[model samples]
Target: MSAAPEQAVAGRLSFLDRYLAVWILAAMALGLGLGRVVPGLGDALAEVTVTGVSLPIALGLLVMMYPVLAKVRYDRLDTVTRDRRLLLPSLLLNWIVGPALMFALAWLFLPDLPEYRTGLIIVGLARCIAMVIIWNDLACGDREAAAVLVALNSVFQVVAFSALGWFYLSVLPGWLGLEQSGEMGSHLLEQSRELGGVSVWEIARSVLIFLGIPLTAGYLTRRIGEKAKGRAWYESELIPRIGPFALYGLLFTIVILFALQGDAITSQPLDVARIALPLLVYFALMWAGSMALGRSVGLNYSRATTLAFTAAGNNFELAIAVAIATFGATSGQALAGVVGPLIEVPVLIGLVYVALYARRYFTTPAPLTEEDPAHA
Candidate 1:
């Protein structure tokens, strides 16, 4: 698709797409209202657990994650080598710049609330793996590169998230003078110990269920469907219909969570917003930085969109699971993670529109030619 029409047309969000923010807001209202009225319901659902993860939220995470993962073009991963121009800057942004910026924002915004700050930093460490795929597709991004980056980021998260969460919550806060000693110091150490006490294996299990399962399913579905129905029809006819389910799952998850956390949220509206501040700042900063980086490097709009969304989006499910496990269900940290998707869905959707417009600023790179002296 030509970039202009793809974006102009992409701007025309469907009924669900257009009112997604409304739906999310409605979900939040409904959940918070339910929390006040039928607090028992959220409590009952929380009790229904397996493998230390909340069953309802776990189901939601699976539904939310699978469709996005299923769309990834794993077969195209090998071709990403030709995309070094995109890859080099992309790696630097997501791994290095993105994290650094998020860390700074979390600290800058949440100096008073260490638990929420820890939660935000944990999320910062886990880059967008699944949601970016959906956002990339919406913006007509380089889906192949999105898939490869998502895969690579997921692998990296499995090993790094827990370790970094420990480090950020433990050493950095004290080192930076953000945290103080005495009883508060003891409390900080306890939070760190609780977080550190979570074995990487526990997180690995969640990764297996949430990411590993869906990734495998996505691969198998692609392989089997292509064999049975052929690639063109599968891509053309089926993928579109299958994609909306991810959004549906996302909305449902929000409803249930807000119902659970609504009381806490209602009581301290400011605190909830406090946790959101760092996140909001992080998303805006990362998206702008990534767009600037991609444009400066002469990337095409598609690849640039991929990098921007990849840098801006995050793996909230994993972040949430780790938070709930490390802290109690009702902890501020868990609340910080729950609100992630509520804020994320709207922000990313808006950025998709913004990215489409921003595409014009960058010059698309000319293909390498054997006749060019630089190539020689």
Candidate 2:
């Protein structure tokens, strides 16, 4: 299939594409309502043990992560690295620009609102993982660029997440007098602690368990299946069958997450809107900025969209896990993190369509080139 048609197919099947941002918003409302109405629900669910870890939320995340990791084609890594302009721009946007914009916005608009501010920062600091690939693919972006960006962001998040959290909560606020500028820096500080604990080991473990294991398993499974079934089986049947599981797993996780936090959502109805505004703005700004940067660097439409979507999305699963761990369930930081999916999925879907329409504007056919060396 051609890239455009394949993207359309992916979009047709993606729940993220179908609902736009509304599903995530609905999930937030559902989760908050569930959390508040049955106060013990999260507690009860939290106690359910899985391999000595009693965390239903974490388990849900683990399951959801599997399909995403499974879908990664490691062989494409080389191709990804060949495109240095795309890779560097993606990193700069995610690590430097994206986080900085989020911190500034949080400080500017939410200093008085500690939970909201912290939550916004947590969501912002997180880079894309699974969903960006889907968005890129759906937008007919350069697949290799998308893959490279995901790998790079995943590695960067490990090192930068903690420091960025600390800077936003501790240093930035004082420098900006976010204290006197808002509700008082104390609430911001208190919320910052909830958002910025350095649990590199915990995060590493989760990433390993959820992402690494599945990635290894998927690669092995693909290789084994290819050998057993031959080339035809690999191409015509296997990938298509397994590919959709990631989407299903994502939806199931979304449902449970919402169910767990439903009540809290119900009580604070407007919180979703409040949390979503900065995210919406961030997405637009990042996407536009990436496109402009890509054009300035003389990239084609596909590579530009790959960079744009990659920079625009967030890894909500990682953010949520970190938020819950640092802030506890009730903290606004956690709530803000939870609200990310609500905003991200739908907005990205719309962006996918927009990118499709915009492609013609940047349709300068470059030499069909090989993948990147770093990806190799």
Candidate 3:
């Protein structure tokens, strides 16, 4: 964070990274315009699916995830596992605090909009498994730590998502005496049944397709690349060529994702705003609080940033799928699910910058020996 390190970090960014916000905004606008103007765009995109996952979005996620995952020093992961300070807090924040906080905010912010409130709670229960890697990488977070924590989350998500959905949407509210609050309480059981209809196998399938493919590919790529060539050539020659694809993939995915819902987003401006407000507050508080907790527990800047991003991000793909399956594509709950990434993408990008700036306060850099995980 000294002027020298700050300047060095700034200098390290490529042109694409330097202007990431501009490219993302342009992608969003382009997607909205295309959706607004193009005929059958959504249907066309939807036609190409691999086991119910959108091909275009899947491609982008795979592309983005591979390079970052390949960058991890997989052998050094043992060090991360041994660090209870990092692992324990990550579990607590993602499973416990994250959902509970979102539940409170949904009730506090959208008291009358029961459907939207339910959607936000569902979003909270689905922890981050995909895009957190990109955010953490961009912020110079510890790649090994991010990988380990994300995998941990994926396991926990499969086990807990439905049960927690039941709790927050139905049981927890009743426990707090909100069961007699009229329509919201009366419909809790019905809503819980609808949300709970998404089976565990379905959620696990999502995790496998989205996270599993890229993770396996990334691991194989590193192993093969290093074996085919020496580690030096693999790192110095091949990585730079593949590195920019992550951004390209991100922009492509954004355009397609927003294009799919462009009409809804542009037409239902006020509704989008309503869904967005709680998401905004949720991301900000979760990221900042996680960062503070990480620092307090003696993590270095890289690990701390990794912790914050992973803690703050939600698996919107899962959330959207569950919402649509449970409540229909045209329902308010589904719309709330779509608006999640609409707000999350831009907000998280901004937080990456905030994290970089705040790195100055950490003072001492975390030691990274030859065995340590390097920045992705």
Candidate 4:
């Protein structure tokens, strides 16, 4: 924790980690160019589907999440769970506040654009389970805390996604007389009719594929690695080897996503801008508010950073899959889903610097208990 050790750590970072933002931007540009120049490229990727989910995208997410989860000291997760200060605020932000905030922003900003609005709502409901680990780790968050929170979000996602979709898209909108706007109401009704209800089964399938596979892989890797070579070897030797893959996977996913949606994003600049506005506001507010809440509740820097990133990030993989499955790959809803990452990637990367800077404001958190694993 001294300056010399910190300096050594900084010096040890791979060129990739040090310039992650540059790589991500280059990937976006490359994907956009590929999609534009190569006819049928997006369709080709779309066709490479397994169980109705895009195979390429799924692989990227799994690869992206696996290493970070593997790095968690799973045995210490109870520390996070018993600390109600972290757990309660995280749940409140991710489950209750996040979805409602997005719904409000979507409606407020895109009242007449039913497809994009609905897409934003769906993004809000699918809480972050995959790429959030990357953001959290980059911001030097509590790894074990992130692991627990991501698991919690996955469970809540399966249980609550469909019901929330019903509420936001159909039930609550009507209750608020949002449907009274004649033509827009009729358009939304027709859109809803076309899409049917958000399928619980599909959402569950996504959670299983995206979270379950990597989580299982990570747990077994740690268990087997530690049992064979001991924790020291696993941590000091193995973790560094695998750690870079998380960012690699992230960059790969970005390229594929932008490629698939390049034409839509390029042609409909104004629509993308409309969707991006709400999303920008949503990410900024959620992250800043969660950080403030964490500091107010006396959390240290790490858990507070974890809370902010997890609350700010959405499971865009799930959101996009659902949009394509329900609304067709080319629909405005799917376009909005694509735009989620466009805004999120650079913004969250910027917020990582903001978080490291803000760390000075948080006092050292008290120990979880006498036997706090972190302190030990």
- TM-score for each candidate, following the candidate numbering: 0.85, 0.80, 0.94, 0.92
Roughly what TM-score does model 2 have, to 2 decimal places?
Answer: 0.80
lDDT of 4: 0.84
lDDT per residue (tens digit) for residues 297-325 in model 2 = 98888788888888888878677767777
The better-scoring model by lDDT among 3 and 4 is 3
Cα lDDT of model 3 by residue, 277-300, tens digit: 999999999999999999999999
Which model scores highest in TM-score? Answer: 3
* Residue 268, model 1, lDDT: 76
Question: How much lDDT does each candidate structure score?
Answer: 0.73, 0.68, 0.85, 0.84
Candidate 1's residue-wise lDDT over 26-98, tens digit each?
8778888898788487777677888776677767767876766666677777777577878788778877777
Off by over 4 Å in 2: 1-40, 49-73, 180-184, 190-197, 364-376
**In model 4, where do residues sit more than 4 Å from their true spots?**
1-8, 180-184, 193-196, 365-376
State how far residue 74 of model 3 sits from its true place (Å).
Answer: 0.5
lDDT of 3 at 130: 94
lDDT of 4 by residue, 1-376 (tens): 3346445555656677667779989999988888888898988988998988889888998899898889888899889999999999999999899999999999999988888998998888879988888888877789899988988998888888777777778778888888736776677666655444667788788889988899899999999999999998998888878877888899999899888878888888899999999999999999999999998898998999999999999989888887877777778888889999989988998898788767757776322221111111
lDDT for position 288 in model 4: 100
